[model samples]
Target: MSRAEPKTRPSDPRFSSGPAAKRPGWSAKSLELPSLGRSHRAPLARGRIAHAIELTRTLLEIPADYRIAIVPGSDTGAVEMAMWSLLGPRGVDVLAWEHFGGLWIKDIVDQLRLEDVRVLVGAGDIRHRLTMVDWQRDVVFTWNGTATGTCVPGADWIEYDRQGLAICDATSAIFGEPIPVSKLDVIAFSWQKCLGGEAAHGVLVLSPKAVERLLSYTPPWPMPKLFRMKDSAGLLPGLFSGNTINTVSLLCVEDAIDSMEWAISIGGLSALHQRVRDNYQVVADWVAASPWADFLEAVEPCRSRTSVCLRISDPKIAGLDVAGQHRFTSEIAQRLDNMGAAFDISGFRTAPPSLRIWCGPTVETNNLKALMPWLDWAFAEQELHLHQHS
Candidate 1:
């Protein structure tokens, strides 16, 4: 029989992986900024942008020499910008375990039309063996698989003193997860994830090696102003400063700063990580107890602490093919969303059928705790719905 309706619900029912929930006490009024209405390049606005970069450096503990910038086009733009600019000089090994990773492969193979490319694919939640990767060539991979719910265990797999650059898409990691920036050459992420800020801008971090590449080589293709990192003089130092390549949303900038300020007040990165731990534990405990569910990324260490993806483990449901299972799981997600117990908990469109919950730093642990029973209720209800429809 279907389980009785859950007694509690998440207070703020937003569990989407991207554009995650705002901090506990966030308000639109908090975004009322001195730079809001002014030009983004103006003194007040530029200062705010500069402050965001410093906060990012402090929160992420980036090395003193690493150059960081707020680039246009969110995380995708940052990744492609680096790829287009720096990839042609050497062979590249691109890893694709999930949706975003696949996009980077396309950029390298199709867009850039580079012949010397090795695509290492780890479909589903499994990991591509890093041992198989040739680190001598430039390598690009996602730090966390947002869609697959898997991540590289750590930077141990990456060669410490390799000749190639390690370009990483860290959109779903960063603030909630500890990243050894020293292990990476180029890193990209957006404020819309862990920080729960507004979007359309990305943070790009470049190591000294990355800077050397920009100074030494240039892409043969026409560099869109958004992708251009340097001009005839040298690396665009102003990009790392307050000057952006194009106009940026001041509203988003204000929101990003507001979120970072909140993070600082709550003991900074350590505090944010604690919140991630607490929230993930809430789901992990529920999954442990649930007879009907399990983590999509089967390996414990590979599971994402922020975008926690789960699959149905019930034999009857699990036996179905991908499309059929997706329909069933989508129903369960829809029911929870309709009841206002959760929102956008369904897996990504391209990924296997699953429930992907945002257990990021901004999410309150109590909310996830309240969400657990509702998930059970939704699953049971969906089971009954399938029977009745049949």
Candidate 2:
């Protein structure tokens, strides 16, 4: 028998991993006070920028010595800037377990064409490979595998006295995971991620060591004006404050401030982390109960609490070949979408067939519980549809 559709729907269904679900009650009216038309150099506009950085530091409990700047582009821009400026000083090690990680490796090898670079990969057991790497080489990696839903268990894997810099692309892990700032040299994330702020700009947090490296070493390659962080005098200190290298949408800035304010009100990072923990627990409980569903990342410690990807192992879906599996997975996601039970829960375009649900802080645990029944209904309906059509 086909299962009946779920009667209760999630109150808010904006669950795309990037530009994720907005804070509860977020609306366009939140931008009313922004310095929209004013010059960013003006005191009012600059103060807004400074406030955003400061609140983010407070919420994230960032160390005082670290510099946080609003940079051009999103997380990609911040990561690339760090790579372009700090990589050539020594040999670099790039690590990958998913799509974003692969892109950084390509940048180091294909784009920069760096001779002394090593790429380590595996969706599971990457920590073992990381243990074997020469820490003397500058290392680049993502804090979370957004596509694969795996993350480094913790910063304990890092060598405390390593000579080279650790540049991490922490776009998805920033608010959702605990990152040891003392161990990371350079970390970058966008406001549009777990915070659920608007996109088109990013925040780059640089440790004092990273700043020192930027000031002392200049890359041999041509640095575009957008990527350059230094001048003849050395690292541009102004950028670390409120001065931006390029124009940003003040509307987005206001939205970021609004989100940061919301974060602080909810007891800051601890509250946010608890919210995500609760959200993930709801799905984890469901997955434990459902014989047909399993996590894409089997390693519990490495699983991402933010982008939760799952594979269907039920005989109905698992027996299908790769192409058939893809179709079946898409059908399930589409059915859920058409029913207004979920949105953007499809796995990444490049990843294997699965469902990638956003379990970030912005999402309420109750909503996830509500959505789970819809997921079960969708899968059943999809199987029935396949049977009738075929």
Candidate 3:
């Protein structure tokens, strides 16, 4: 039997994980461009960058003692900077739950070749291994797995008075979820993720401990100019004060500021969290009734609200081999994209076959509610086609 076209389509179809949907009512005209052509070092441009940093601090509720800097590379660059600058000082415990976390592990073992490293790995749910990690060693993990949509419930598992650092890659979780800033030593995220701003830039937040590590220890490997955060005279004075290590896009700065301002106007962090919660609930409810799909993260607490990844549950699709599953899911995603009901909702290239939806604050709950039916429609359509051909 053929499933009918969805009676309603999502008002806006963008659902990409990164470079995700823009904030509601967002437009290019909404961005302030006075600093567009100006040099990054210019007063106007520098001021905008500084404002963006401050806005990030305010919205995310980062502690005053923590320093925030706008770095050259997006979240990837920021995480690399942290690992390069601090990991040599002590043994580290790294988690390899998803794409980015796995990469961090590779960097720690293969690239850095760190001798004393403990890698704790898991698939959809990694909570059990949390108890296995020794807090005495520096810990590297993603607060939320962007690819798998699994997240640690909270920071309570972290040792408050541990001897080592807690470095986190929180690109997709920053504004979209609540983060405990005090427990983290090095936190990295990109403007393009939760803020729905443009790419090519990352925000690095450092606890006082992270700064002390930077000032005290230097990695044995060469540090690139882009990753260098300090100099001979203590830390770089201007680096955190909007004096970026390299040239930055002034236009992107304005866009980040615009997003932050929008976030602030809409009741700040709590409001953003509420928006994410509501949006996730809409998808969760749909999945609860979905005969063919369910979230990859089975544990409710561990499931990420921002990146909601769903796996196919239908017998025909689930029984397929890895490559077959990939091809099937990719085809469905392409069909949805072509139908103009959704776009970029496919699973991460490195992840298992699944549908990853962005339920960040920028994405509207109404749109997600509308999108649920379309998802069912697409899945059923694919099933019908399979039945006829096979």
Candidate 4:
């Protein structure tokens, strides 16, 4: 018996992982009044940036002493800023399970030529191995690995009285996952990820410890102007207050503010958390019943609710060589895209061939429910195409 294509379709299909879908009712008209022609250092422009920083802090429940700054080059920039300034003070532990984490490891081990660095690697979940690390050394890891849909469960395993800083790349997990601000010394996230804002700017949060490190110490290497966060006057206070080191698109700031406002209206962080869970649950339920696919993260607790990755499990699809598997999954994603049922569902090229769906707060649960049957339809179409061609 052959399965018939579902008649119903998702109302919206703009689910790329980064620059994820915007808030349900967002409009370009809402951003028309941004300080387009004025200097970013202009009073009004600076105020807008400061307002965004303040609102983000309030919504995320960051500690009062922790400072927030908007930085250049998105989350990567912010993470590197922390590394360049703080790593040499002590030995460093670099952990990885996926793409972004691996990138940071390379920067610390290869680029910076840090002699005391220790690298820890894992295939899916790296949380369990946190115990083996020496807390006396600075720790760097990703709170959520967007490439593989895995995340550190929480900060429970971290030592409370440890002498090291915890720097996290939380670009995809900030809004959806609850972060223990007290346990983290530095956190970096981009507006483009879970917040559904425009790209190229990052939000960097620093604990008092991180700030102290910056003020008291500096990397031996000459830092780029874009990465400089401190000077003779001490830490650049204005950066935290929205006087950016470089110009930013006022339009993007306006859009970020709009998204943050929408998040607040919908009940802040708790609501955002529930939104992602509900969206993930929709796909989770489908995957539970669908024999053709399964989540890449075998450990349920470690699976990411935002970037949900699904691997083809059926032997017919899974038996193919890596190149063939990529082609098959590409075909499925392409078929779905052509049908307007989904967009950008292909897994990261660096990752194994699979499908990754964005289940962040901006993605509607109803739309995800509407999408599953279409996924089934697409899979069937791909199977039939491969059978005929072979």
Model number with the top lDDT = 3
Candidate 3 segments exceeding 4 Å error:
none
Q: Model 1: number of clashes?
A: 0
- Each prediction's total of clashing residue pairs, residues at least 3 apart in sequence or on different chains, is 0, 0, 0, 0
For each of the candidates, the C-alpha root-mean-square deviation to the true structure, in angstroms, is 1.3, 1.2, 1.1, 1.2
Angstrom error of the Cα, residue 353, model 4: value is 1.0
lDDT of 1 by residue, 1-390 (tens): 667897888899999898999988999987857787799879888998899899888888899899999999999989988898889888999987789999999999999999899998854434455778888899999988889788788788888898999999999999988888898999999999999988899999999999999999977888888898898899776899789989999889889988998999889999999999999999998888899999998888778899999999999899988998999989999999999999999999998899999999999999998998898888888898888887
TM-scores for all candidates: the values are 0.97, 0.97, 0.98, 0.98
TM-score for candidate 2, residues paired by index = 0.97
Q: Which is better, 1 or 3, measured by lDDT?
A: 3
For model 4, residues 45-64, the per-residue Cα lDDT tens digits are: 88888999999999999878
Model 1 per-residue lDDT at 4: 88
* Whole-model lDDT values for every prediction: 0.89, 0.88, 0.90, 0.89
Error of 2 at 290 (Å): 0.6
Span of 10 residues, lowest total lDDT, candidate 4: 122-131
Error of 2 at 329 (Å): 1.1
The local distance difference test score of model 1 is 0.89
> Which candidate, 1 or 2, has the higher lDDT?
1
Sort the predicted structures by TM-score, highest score first: 3, 4, 2, 1
